[model samples]
Target: MTFDPTPPHEPRRPPPRSALGPRQLVGAILVLLPVVLLLGGLSRCSFAPGGPEIDPSAGPAVDAPALLRDAARLAPFAVRIPAVPPGWRSNAVDRATVAGGPGTAVRAGYVTGAGRYLELVQSDAPEEALVRDVAGTVPPPTGVVDVGGTRWVVYGGDEALWVADVAGVRLLVTGSAGEDEFRTLAEATLAGETLPAGTPPPR
Candidate 1:
């Protein structure tokens, strides 16, 4: 047998080494990370905290005339006593009768004052009815105040006068419109006419 052996096959050349080493991979990642972060920051800057940009001033403008009309609608009905000062406006008068009474009592009034708006409500419900109604609706009086020697119970939002020891007269000065505006309206209304003694309160 001819035992001539062909030269051993040359060792297979090792696969070509990768050009990227671990350090090169890390460097490439570090370079790209800042670019990614910059893009993210720019995207965030274009929008608000949660989402789309919103123009703060883009809202409905207030309509003063419309507000005044609404206020007129909510205003209590009242007769503008002839004594109401010039420039004062009043709504039509309405009457409410007490559950039981001798003669019908009249109730009417308007807003007054400068700083805070005051709702002036006047009613002739007879002292008993006035006190009863007030007690029914509001907290008890803080204390009684004597005006002109007449004992008048003063609730937070109302006042009562005892007429003929049985009949009631009430002047409700409400801080309802709130303290600031109430002061303005109160002063204005108070400046107007005093309610007639027998004006009936509306039911």
Candidate 2:
């Protein structure tokens, strides 16, 4: 028998299918990860209109009286802790230097019985300067509201500011609380007494 020069013909095979390599697979996963996370986040968001409704009374209660006592000792001006009515809660208190000037600013925030927020800022700063700092800018007084015969100059519309000079310091009442709640806080603050002098705890 004659020996064949060429080997027997083999069956032709198709070329291998293209696929993502290790580096390409990692790159694709990286690109897809942010999109997946963003979609997940969007799915969890509320689509309802209007701003978020906050529960002002939800936070931890603070010892406003004790805080005010400490602030009174350190502050140049007297600090009076408001006798917040029943169901109202004090949420925060802070004592800091007046912005852009010398003097102390003692702030105590409260959540009213109706779940509205109000902040009282008693400062030794000048009326104009303190109001400017607290109000962010001195908008013209919208009007005036009387709290226990004390006249409080009003500023802004919806977000109101009721400011008055009581005893020896300026008291600013501002927040989401309604005019009535604002009046309540203002009245309470005005009615309250200044903390007694002597050795006091750190502010």
Candidate 3:
């Protein structure tokens, strides 16, 4: 037998390290960098300080009597002796009265930084007592201006009292109604009264 001398075979080369090119690497970095930054920003925002921390009991205690006195001072006409109810806080006062005449009134008084009054009335008086009352609670009317196309007596106080007519419902008690509520009550009152055309509803 003839023994053939043969050279040893060479080993196969390994595959290329990766198919990613420089452009692909740059594109990936550009896309992923923004994602990483976004994640970091979201994490920082979640852990950031100075976020809203509310304590249900942290605010100043409400004083109803004090609110009533402030309301009296702010009201245009004298505040009839207010009969504050028990547990009333001096920082907030609301009163209601039904006179036997052509008027029914609802009043809300509050002192947030300063005094604020909101009143509703149905009467033929030149100025609605409720409007006067709220204006009185405010600093004082600088001048009359139109709000939402309706003319109102404006004032400067911590907050201003707003009055508008509500369209139905005969008697409404104060404290039970809000600013919009009083407006609704005033509108209702006007509809019931059926005043002459172009006559402004009682404030």
Comparing 1 and 3 on lDDT, the stronger one:
1
lDDT score of residue 108 within candidate 2: 95
TM-score, one value per model: 0.33, 0.71, 0.24
Give candidates' CA RMSD values in order. Answer: 18.0, 7.6, 17.3
- Candidate 1 runs further than 4 Å off: 1-87, 100-103, 113-123, 131-138, 144-152, 157-172, 175-203
Q: Ranking under TM-score, best-scoring first? A: 2, 1, 3
- Name the lDDT value of residue 17 in candidate 3: 42
Task: For candidate 2, write residues 1-203 as lDDT tens digits.
Answer: 99977668966665453754788778888999999999999997764332233465588898898878877777776678788788888988998887876667899988877677789999878877887788777888888888899989998844678888876678999888677888899989988867643337553
Candidate 2 yields a Cα-based lDDT of: 0.80
Pairs of residues clashing in candidate 2: none
TM-score, cand. 3: 0.24
Candidate 3: tens digits of C-alpha lDDT, residues 1-203: 97756645866676574976788779888989989999998876533132222232344455543443444443333332223333322333354443333433434332211122223333232334444443343244555544345444444444444333322322222222234533433343333323322333233
Candidate 3 Cα outliers beyond 4 Å, as residue runs: 1-95, 98-102, 106-128, 131-139, 163-203
